[model samples]
Target: MIRQYDLVERVKSYYPAVDESLLNRAYVYAMKMHGSQKRASGDPYFSHPLEVAGILTDLKLDPATIVTALLHDTIEDTEATHEEIARLFGEEIAQLVDGVTKLTRLELTNEDSKQAENFRKLILAVAKDVRVLLVKLADRLHNMRTLEHIRKPESRRRIAQETMDLYAPLAGRMGMQGFRDQLEDLAFAELNPEARDAVKSRLDLKQEKSRDLVVRIADEIKRRLAAVGIEAWVSGRTKTAYSIWKKMERKSIALEQLSDIYGFRVVVDSVDDCYRALGILHGAWPMVPGRFKDYISTPKGNNYRSIHTTVVGPERERVEMQIRTLEMHEVDEFGVAAHWFYKDYVENGSKKSVSASDELVAPFRWLREVVEMLEHDATSEEFLEHTKLEMFQDQVFCFTPKGRLIALPRGATPIDFAYAVHTDIGDRCVGAMVNGRHMALRSELQNGDEVEIMATGQQVPPLSWDDIVVTGKARAAIRAHRRRAEREQYVRLGRGIVEASLRTEGLPVDEAALEVVVHDLPASTLESLFEQVGRATLNVETVVRAMLVHFTPEKKSRRPKIKGAKVAAGSERAREDGTLPRGRPDAIPITGAGVGTSVTLSPVSLPIPGDRIVGIMQPGKGVEVYRIDSPALAAYDDDLDCWIAVKWDIDADEHRQFPARIALVLANAPGVLGEVATVAGKHGANIENLTTTDRKPDVYEMTVDIGVESAQHLERLLTGLRGLKSVSSAKRVYG
Candidate 1:
């Protein structure tokens, strides 16, 4: 264990005016609180926090961070309380300790939810004070270092997977490459021990065979740069086993085929020297095409800056090199910690303000967005989904019309860009322009493209928009809108059913009576009761029957039956041949069709304005519309009392098109798809989408979505498709 005096001296080495007395007090408190506790490694439990503090010292973090690292586990494992820590240390340290404690105490039912819920709390906590995250990362790093001592293999694997999925990516996003690399390697060792060991053995053999290769390369780079009068420090090393294995797997190549496994870094005194050093290195070797990137000019969202290039150098070997200024080097290695090195610390026992400056806080914009998302009405599973989408994708930086930069995932669409701008914009977006040219709303955004969103005043978003967007914000917003719309639709249908049912019973539904009935039920409001009825949770007949029993106990009434238009069996139905249909005064019109609707010949064998449609009233659920012979109608035969009569509106426009789905089994041969397309076109059918799958060596199955004028038109198209020699089967798929 590190001595208290030695720890204080280490802090003073970087922060000479750090609060030494406070540090001493915290050290003693942690040691005393954790008395008699032993780690899985059989060492004093105090040694864990001590080692965590030692790790943060290497990052040169603020004194408060170092202190919090010492006490992060106290409230969770020891008898210490947050209030006591506050009284002794201060509120800042107490708050940080509370945050870490909450993270530690998360108990979830399964691993997936556990990981997501833990990250949810982590984001919320870190949004207030970034130092809390820094301290927790250090804590996780130390725990991983001692993970081998844990007895159970399953427990170790779970911890390693979580570290790889959560902590490592977070550290990388924060620009802490050193921490990210170490965490990944440690986790990889447990998750894939054989693969890791094999890669390590290969690396060890390479290192032994080329004992002086790294030194020779570093010396040669130094000698060349010195000749150019550019003072620089050049260092080289082999990539980590995890990174090497990942590269090989990603490229589908053997280890020997990898050329950039050996890498070098050149740190200089000034930004000018960084470019100058790059020029000298390139001048001395042949540059590799498509392998150069200038992150210095266009830094990553994490604020990482460097110039990377691959070149054939020193013995004609392909090598990777990164050049940056000394300041950039420090910031790249230590990330946010380097920023605190120059800040003034609190003195005289006064507390420092927790708020950070805009520049210092800018890199955490994604974190703030996540916090905002938590406020939305999303379930734990949904929260996890969006957060994972936000965390685990490479970014493409684009510009708004006004030159504002918006960073998004590589495959994000314009809808995602709109959501990134603001939620309102995304909800109302109708179209977009990319780089001043109108493009499809689902078009993938490219780096540096200027996006312009065209939004309308409409409040409801399209349900299909969910499939077009890739970002979490856009998907979440679309889902929220759809949920609200579905609720309203259900409520409307439920109200109509209840009102009609009451009229049949010769009773009036008044607000007072409705309120009384709602109060007697499980619902909190009249609207909620109606919503329940619409959702089929509460049977409309039951509510009406209950209402009659309460409002008119002396009168016995018969249940209302749905009246249907009487038609002779096998009578000529409304045909889609553009002929006028015989009018029935008793027919009820379907919603969306105006009065005096006429049944038209449907172009496809699909639901058309003139189909034999009926409405099925569910108990609490409103009504579901289905064709008379449809497969869905078979599901509700047990509840025949809920069935209602419905018909096509005669006033529906004849020019409107309806979609139809068709399945075709065809002989596997060239020109078969073309022949099907030709047949569809000849019948005036528009193919909207088509998917082909191989069912056998010589046969294929195809599903096609086509738009047609009427059911007759669709029948003609299906007949035409069946006439083709390549097509073995053709039929309309009914829902």
Candidate 2:
């Protein structure tokens, strides 16, 4: 059992004026309540809450937040209720406890929902009151620190994955570099054990041999700063396990081949002193070329500011050096908590404001942006995949015409730039000028490009624009546009289907008729009906039948002539011939057409429904329903035939297993393939083949063809596939 005195003593140290009597009574109540409880590590359950409260104290949160931390698990795992908490404390304290309590009851069906919705809830709760997030971060930090005690391999993997995807990124967003680094190290230790061990062993060996040399270097730097009448502190340390893993992957170097396994930090008194120290250090050791960054001038999007330089030490061994002020160092390690720690100084006599530092504010903005992108009803897999991509990004600093810096992810193009500026700019973007020169909207932006967005009133977002956009923000906007367009199309189609039925029943079809039929239904129900029609769930026949029963037509309206054409037949010969053109191919003769009838724009590798698309067509492949784009046929524009008017194949006697695409985004490890194969078998999936391709650093993209009965089967299989520790996304291959 954890001693009650320790919790009270820690609280007293932070808040000498606090009421110790209340804390002692609450401690006694908690100890008795959790007396029989134990953790996965077999520690007393009371220890967890006490430790959580201690962490809250370390973070310098208010007393209410600390108390909430102590009682967070009580209502969830014990007999206590929100009312009970409110009765014991006040409403504000109970509310805080409730917020922290909500973080635990997450019901995630898939990994994506587990990540996106959970984090979405977490961040929005934090945004309301930042302290809730601070305490939760502390709680997660401790859980990660002791994750190894969890016996099950699957449980360990899930926790590690959750840490990397949710907690670590959150810590980074909050500017808590120390906690973020430790969480990442712990996660890497569990998820990629071999890489973690290799990096740890190599770093240990380097530290064993170079400890004396590093100490001497630090001593010399301290002496030099002292002689210059500048008081400072210097320290040398090996990189964390996660940092080492990233470096090896980034440089594509083996552990034994890694050169810079250590870093040296110099903490000074002011920003000027930081730069002065950097200059002094460079004078002592030759600076490495192209290894200097002055973040103080242009801070990271995460709001971290420092001056970094790499230099050659005594034996010409490369040593990375970071210089910052003591205040910067404090913020660097503790993030926003440092402000609370020094709140007394700032409030009474110190020369600073008590508000959050810019670093704290900046990360919240980015985190909110990410949360917005993820909360668009995106599937858990997609949300997790895209969020990971965005979070793991390396920023590129581009400039607007006004010389304002706009930081974006590396590989982000001008389209992403326009979207970043505003949704209106993205919708109206026609072209762009980079550095006063015309450039393609898809051109990758580089550092320091003074880009000017060129737009026309006639411009609109293209459905295929998402294929070229790299950022999650841009993609979310594009998806929103697509959803709107789809809804509009369904509304029009529903109107037409309703009108035709009313006309056949001798009733004049009008808005009044629609109102009568939909009188009892919500507006959303009408919208959903239209969507169902668009997706071929409720066909025109079904809509007509429903309308005929509801309305009577008054007069006949002239109907357009229906074209009569033979439905093209499909055969295995079509697959073998490969005559169905796709992907930038010239027009070819379609044998099914009448003599002298022309067929142009034969899409290669795309299945056109009416044209008897064989293996040449794919589910997602956009193929021409018609050979050309026409304004009157807006429904069929942009590979119209690719939008197959699919109906229920009621007469089909057999359930066919069509080839569906399964992509695995996994950590490239030795036994990962075997593990994935085992899981696939467990989930009743027959993998036809698997092909692997390397993506940037540690992750690989593998494609596998699997047989599935329908979309639901595929969803279940993909869900199982993603449950594998390393797999990122699993979905059908739609072109």
Candidate 3:
């Protein structure tokens, strides 16, 4: 364990202006608070915080961060209070300590929820001040180092998994590669010890066999750079065990097949010298094909900048190399800590401050994005899902038409790009062009591709966009819109059902009376009650029955005569022609004589030319509509009690698309699939999806989802398929 004075002296070395008395007070306070406690390793509990503080000192963080490391666990494990810490160290350090304390008191039901909630809190804390993350990372590092002493395999595994899943990635995102590698290796050992041990053994053997190869390559690189009049330092090392194993698994190759496991770094004095060193090295050796990335021109979101390349070197061995300036190297290793180091140096008047923007260099922007996501209403599971998608995927850089750069995760589509640009743009996007040509909205973006989104003020977001977009922001926005739309649809359906029920009971459709009754129910508003009924959570019949008990019926003689609902002109013409109405209506409008009341056409058997098809309200689900004799009606036998009467409006449009499923049995031979597709295409049917269920000696069963203009259009497609000699049978699947 590092002694108190030694730790203070280390911090003072980098930041001489740090308050020595504050450091002494924090050290003594933490030690006293944890006096009689012992860690799982059978050592003084204070030793853990002391070690964590020592780790932060190595990072050369600000004084408050080091102090935060010392007192992070006091409020959680001891009698120490936040008020006392504030009184002693001031509110900044106190808040930092409070933020670092693990969220253990949340009463979540499952372990996943609890873990997600804890992470959510940690992110919110880090968004306020990034040092909270720095200190928390150091605290976790010490715990991981001592994890083996816990003695409980399950506890150890859980901690290791959390570290691997959350903390390690966070460190990497902060550009702390050294910290990330250590955390990952330690966690990998506990999570999959056998695999880790195997990789380690292989690495050891390789290192032993290549004893002088790394040194020889480093020396040769140094010599080459010197010959070019470039002052540089070269170093080499074997990749970490976790990294090697991950690459092998990702590529599905054996350990021996890994060619770039040996890596070399060339550190130069300036950015210009870094590129100059790279040119010299590439000229000296044969470069591996497709093994170069120029991150210096376009740095990573974490601000990692280096020139990475693979080249055949001195011994004809394939080696990976990274070239960067000394400053970039420092940032790559220490991340945000390097900024503090530079800041401190500038304050001491020993060096000039770099011109990088603090916002671009800090990790808080990403942290704030996560914190903003929490403001939207999403389930714990959903929040975790989106956050993992945001944090874990590799990134691809794209460009706007005007050349502005936008970085997104791999497999992200234009929807994600639009959202990344602005929320309004995503909401208004109607189409997109990739590389100056129109493409599908779901087309995945590639690196360096320029995208131009076409927007329209009148367009609402497509319901299918939720699946096409991969980013959390786009998904959250899409889901929010869908939820609002669904609620509106439910409210409309519920109102129709209530009015139809009232009309059937010979009761007056009084909106005022219904509002009074709805106020007494579980719902807070009349619209909410209708929405509940439409979603089938509240049964329409139950609400009608409740209202009937509260309402008094008017005298029969005084009641006004209700007018008969009119059928659409097209339906009337079809009835006169003795033909059934086979086309779907653009809008299914309900009609009745009473204001705000819908009347159901009686003897609701099969839908006739004059009969209207309306939906039945189901709880949680919005509605289910089916024509009588349809296959879907069979499934609703159990929901017969919830059915309500509905009708089509006279002004309903004739042109509208509806989903239809068709199954076909085709001859299991060449050209049969194409023949069936041709038959459907000849009838103007758009095939959305196709799947084969079973294959026999002579026949195959297949299902296709087709979009049709109406029942008549679907029937025409079915007839065309039935006419094909290759199709054994074709029929509409209504369920």
Candidate 4:
């Protein structure tokens, strides 16, 4: 464990203006508060905080951060309170300590939910002052280093998983590659020891076989840079076991097939020298195709900048390397910890302190976005899942027409692009123009692609967008659009229910009673009260009961009735859910949020009279009806609140023909497709679309979309196709 004088002197070594007395007081206070408390490691609890402070000192953080690390666990684990910390240290250090402290007292049902809630709080705290994150990361790093001391295997695995899932990615996002690698490797060892051992054994065997390979590669790179008169320092090392295992899992390859396991980092004097050195290496070696990325020109959201490339070097090895300036390398390694930066453009190379610039604050913008998203800014249950996925996903940066950059996931579409721009833009998105040409809204975006959104107010979000969009924000926006659009219908329906209840009570329909009820119930306004009633989340008799106290008694023609709590549910009939042919004025409209047109069955989902169905709102196409069990509904699992609850109102629409698609594998003989078409036509099904692909010399695959009356008709057609001698396989397709 680090002693008091040593910790204080270490902070003063870099930050000379540090307060020695403050550090001494904090150290002693932490020690006194944690008296006789022992860690699972059987060490005094004070040693943990001491080690955390030592870790932060290596990062060269501010005095407040180092001091906050020393006392981070006090408010949570010991008798020391936030007020006491504030009284001893300043409010800044106290707040930092509070932010680093976890909310252990929350009554969450399970470990996962508790973990999510804790992470949510951590992000909010980090958003305020990044020093909180610095202190917390150091705290977690120390805990992970001593994780083996945790006796329970379950506890160890849980902590290790949390570190791998959240902390490691966060460190990488903040550009702390060194910290991220160490955290990941330690966590990987705990979580998957067998895989870790397997990777480590392979790495060791390779190292033993060619121990001097990395040294030779570094020397060759240094010599190549020097030949062009560019000064550089090249260092090489093998990747961590966790990193290699991750690559193996991602590429589905074994350790033997994996190339580019070794990496080199080249640090140069200036940006010009960095690029010049990159040119010299590429000119001397054959550059590997599709393996170059220029983060130097376009820095990451975390302000990470470097040029990464792979080349078949003089040793004929697939070697990966990164070229960056000394400053860039420092930021890449230390991230936000390196406070004083931007010495390049300053005259005479005098450094200026800028601890609160865009470079420092940009990475935390993601945390801010996350906080905004958690409050139903998007979907609720899937929000945490998407949040975790975003932490692990590599980002692809694209540009808007106005030159603003928008970063999204690798397979993100134009809809994802629109949402990344703004939620309103996503909701109103109609189409997009990629690189000055019209493209489909579901087009996958690539890095550096200039995209332009074509939006109109009349266009509400399409439910099909849930399938194509990859961002959580876009999914949330899509779900919110339907709920927002339903507010008016809910209000209207609720008003009728309220008026009916009033009529049953022999009272006149009046808005005056709503004011009393709104205050009496869980509603902020009369409209919300009506909305709750319409959605059945609030009972109508409850609304009337609140009004009875304030209502003036009028003459009643009928007095005796059933008890208020036991009103008959089947008696209430609004008849406003149908929209067939406009002949019946009392029919229920069955209208969805933005869907006013006639409902149509999707060609892909093929929902029929006998199948359970839902209405998914689509732009221009009304609510697209889909079967309840379709695979395409998987994306809408989080968006189910937006689905219009649908039921079969008729046996079948006589005039409507539902299109269903089916696939077939058949012997590629003379007339297989023609015979299949004839068989389908005989069953009263019309082939709307047919496409065939040659599978082999003697076999073929074909897809056909046919208009049928119901699932029965489609099933019959499939049966006939299977009976054919040439057809080997025939199956109906949904989704």
Candidate 5:
């Protein structure tokens, strides 16, 4: 346990004029309130908050923040009241405590909706005062440190998973690298103990073999800088076990193959000295190609700035070096916690409240962007899904035509760029010009490329756009628009159905009768009632019964059907070509919708626009489109109500790409894969994915997924592949 005097002294060490009395009072209050309350670990609950405060003290936060950390859980777990805290301390301290209390009460569970709703609250509360997040992070870190003491394995794993998903990434986004690393390592230990232990053992054995390697490297770096008349400090850094494990998973490499594991950091006086040190080091040793990045000129989204390079240095070892100024070093190590200045200044004889500066907001741009997604109407699960998407991606920085920088995920497309700029632009995006040349909307954006989005009111976003866009904001915007479009269609369709039923009964669509129906049902408005009726949640007969004077069960009503070909999908009546006929008034005409997380094309069958397809409505998921004759459709055959008739709405002149798959057997020879890529490129198709399996020692069997204009385009590409000397056989794969 941290003593009250020790806690105050620690704060006073950084802030000479901190309010020691306020902190002391809070410490005593929290301690007494948690009297006999115990944690799952059988320890006094007071110890948790005290340790959380101790953690913040290490971060060098303000006195009020420290006090808030002490009392964060009191309002939720104890008899303490916000009003009492406000009376004892000040309103600012009370409000800070309240904010953190709200976050603590949020029990983020395994359920995505509960977790996402809690995360939403966390973001909104932290956006008001980042200190709340700081307190919450410290609290979580302490809990994680003591996680093993809890008896329930499920509870322990749940907490660990939550830490990895939310707190760890949240810390990184706020520029707290140290906290992020610690949280990740702790969570990684719980989630994958064997993997973590394996990485640690490898590191330990390597350390045993080379006891002085890091020290030798650090000393050599310092000597090199000293020779150049640049006074500097050099320190060694080794990747954490979790970090190494993540790299191994990402690159599919083992610990023995990792070269950049041992590294050094060179910190100098100024930014100019940083470059000078870099030049001297690179000139002294052979620099590794394609391993250099200059983040000083263009900082990361979190405002992390450094110059990273890997080189063949001392003893011909593959060593990594990070060069930065002293200020950058402090900012990199401590992040936003290095600068927590809160003071009450008197202006015009009145106290003006001042917390963190707007400058702090710059590093947290990612947080604000996620919160902005709420306005786009994302569901709870979508909020969680998109937030993870926003958090876990390496960034590629690009520019607008007017020279404004836009930092996006590495594989982001112009659709993502447009959404990042503004949702209106994304919703209306029609085409793009990358670096002043017209590029496909699905083209992966490169760093430093200047993108010019060409949007028009005359164009609606194609369904295939969903496949290319990577950002959460972009996908959420697209889905929101699709929902609105679907709702409008349902409204119109429902109105027609009601009008037809009124004619059958010889009644008119009068306001009096409709209003009665609306009031008697679960709906609050005519559009709401119609939307329900159209979605089939409420039957047409149910609506008609509300207005009938003597409604009886003898008169039955059925769902209105659109007039068209009544032939069931996947039935023997389909065309001989196995393709549905083009123009149908009844069948819902649709273009190729991209694969979805909630609802998508069946994995067993990848259908192009020319294939006979049907839609299956999943309960929680939106709609799953599938090839009619696929074996996977057998599962849904008994339940015809779930089936929806649909047809491709492709125009003959439109050259949009649809997803298709092909299987290939190739002679195992040099340059065979290269030849396959060349053929794919020449046929105007993008090879989205390629997986290879070994048939025998001399043969390679692979599946290739390509985007093409239609089935004909795939046939032409197959013809080109069959002509290759390396390809033994090629055939379209449907499943």
Candidate 6:
């Protein structure tokens, strides 16, 4: 085990002001808290925190952050508490430790969800205090480095994938090139061992063969810079496994297609020297066409500044070169951590605002746009997935109509852009113009293409818009608009039920008649009433009765005084004649047996406009219509008409399906489904469904459907398919 003194010495570079007493106390406390706990590597668990602290120390973070790293895992994994940590250390250190502790304890539904939520929290924490993320990134960096100690392949893959998918991307976002490269390379090794080995072997062979050439070129560049009176440091860099994988994917070429795999960097004293050195390097070697990028003028989203160029060397071999200042190099290596030293001095000891890394911080205006996307009443999953597509996915830069730049993820369209502008515009979008040419809503945006959204004031969003819009914000806004529209529909439906009942009771309701009553109830009250009804609180019929009674109170029986009209005593004729359809009425024909007209026993089974219908006729009463398969009529044993006859509309396509088991058998040959496509083209059948299982030893089972117009057509196809080489069998599964 490493001693506390050695760890303290390692951390001293960042914290010369930190005394030995603080270090000793933290070490003892961490050890006490983690007593006898061992990692899967079988070493003491203290090694993990020591390594984490060392990583933070290398970043040259504050002493408190370093100490917090030492104790970060204590509270979560052991008996240590936040109050205890605060009591032992100062509040700042305790807060950081608690933040990390909370991060450690978070339970995600799955690794990806957990990681995304963690990243969200981590970024928020970083926004509050940048050091929180620094410690976390360092901690993740060390964990990734030591991932081999994990036993399960799945666990290793999960951690590696998370590192590759999230942490490495985050490191790139933070401008930590060195850490990002290493994490990606490490992840690649685990996730794709074969490709990793192949790239490694090829690069190693190339490096061995070109060792002398690299040295000579580096030396020449160093000498050229020295001659120009520009002090510089130059070194060669070998591309890592993940970088080669990315190159292979991007260029659609194998390892042999890659040249200039060996790159060199020239770090100088000043920004001017960086540019001067770039010019000198160009002069030394013939520049490759369109292979130069001056990031110094336009830094990357992560605040990385460099002038990168590839050149054909003396041996006619391509070599990539990067030129940057030493400060830029440090910032490239340490990312946001490097800002601490200079920013502290510049800010005069006060903590700098989140904007301190303005040059380094990725534009979060996109996040604000995402928040707006979520402003729509989108479900959590839809909102989260869409935001993930924008925030967590890779970014593509496009131009707005005015030539201003707008960055979105790959495959984002103008609809996403319109929504990003505002919800109303997105909801009303009718069309779009890409570079001033009208295109479909699904037209993918290309890099640097000027996109103009064409919206209309008269148009409402289509239901299909939910499927087409890609951005989370836009999808959410569209969904929200639809949801509010749906709620309004429900409100109208509910109001209609109440008003129609009032009219039948001789208290007719219209906009003019009900407007006063409606004005008495606010939207909040209406919402509450709906909620109560939805929750099965206040009965709908009772509510209707109360409203009618309130609007038109019951008056005492009286005789009307008309000119020369005979006066009569209190007449019960209208009330007792039963002309109204209150309970069960007479004279109206009931369709089925034992059913009444105008009398619905249960409101739970009320027939609406959209409902399928059935009728039941009663002896003195009239026909009582009932919904098919209503739970309210389930107990009626003798009354068959109470069951009602109903059928769904033949043209209605509004069927919703739960999960169903589908079995598929793919052809047992190489490239068979590509084979099936060739075979399917022979037949006039279109594949409506396809699903496959994981690969087994030989034959793969996949469920596929070839749509047929009729049962005879399906049978004809099946009969012909009995022994057609790849078609072993075909069957339909009802489930």
What's the residue-level lDDT of 434 in candidate 5? 98
Model 3 quality (TM-score): 0.82
Worst lDDT window (10 residues) for model 6?
Answer: 561-570
Across residues 657-696, which tens digit of lDDT does each residue of candidate 1 receive? Answer: 6677889999988999999999998988899998875578
How much does each candidate deviate from the true structure in C-alpha RMSD? 6.7, 15.5, 7.1, 9.6, 8.9, 13.8
Give lDDT: candidate 2, residue 659.
50
Clashes of 5: 2
Off by over 4 Å in 5: 38-43, 510-513, 548-735
Cα displacement (Å) at residue 68, model 6:
1.5
Q: Model 2: how large is the Cα RMSD against the reference? A: 15.5
Q: In model 5, where is the ten-residue run with the lowest total lDDT?
A: 577-586
> Candidate order by lDDT, highest to lowest?
5, 1, 3, 4, 2, 6
Q: Put down candidate 6 lDDT per residue, 18-60, tens digits, no spaces.
A: 6678878998899889999999989899889988988877787
lDDT of each: 0.77, 0.66, 0.76, 0.75, 0.80, 0.64
Q: Estimate each model's TM-score.
A: 0.82, 0.73, 0.82, 0.76, 0.76, 0.66
Clash counts per candidate, in order, are 25, 18, 6, 10, 2, 11
Report the poorest 10 consecutive residues by lDDT, candidate 1: 576-585
lDDT of 3 by residue, 232-279 (tens): 889999999999999999999999888888999999998899888888
Candidate 4 ranges with C-alpha deviation above 4 Å: 103-111, 339-360, 375-380, 500-506, 544-735
TM-score attained by model 6: 0.66
lDDT of 4 by residue, 52-85 (tens): 8998888887777778888988999888888989
Worst 10 residues of 4 by lDDT: 579-588
430 Cα displacement, candidate 6 (Å):
4.8
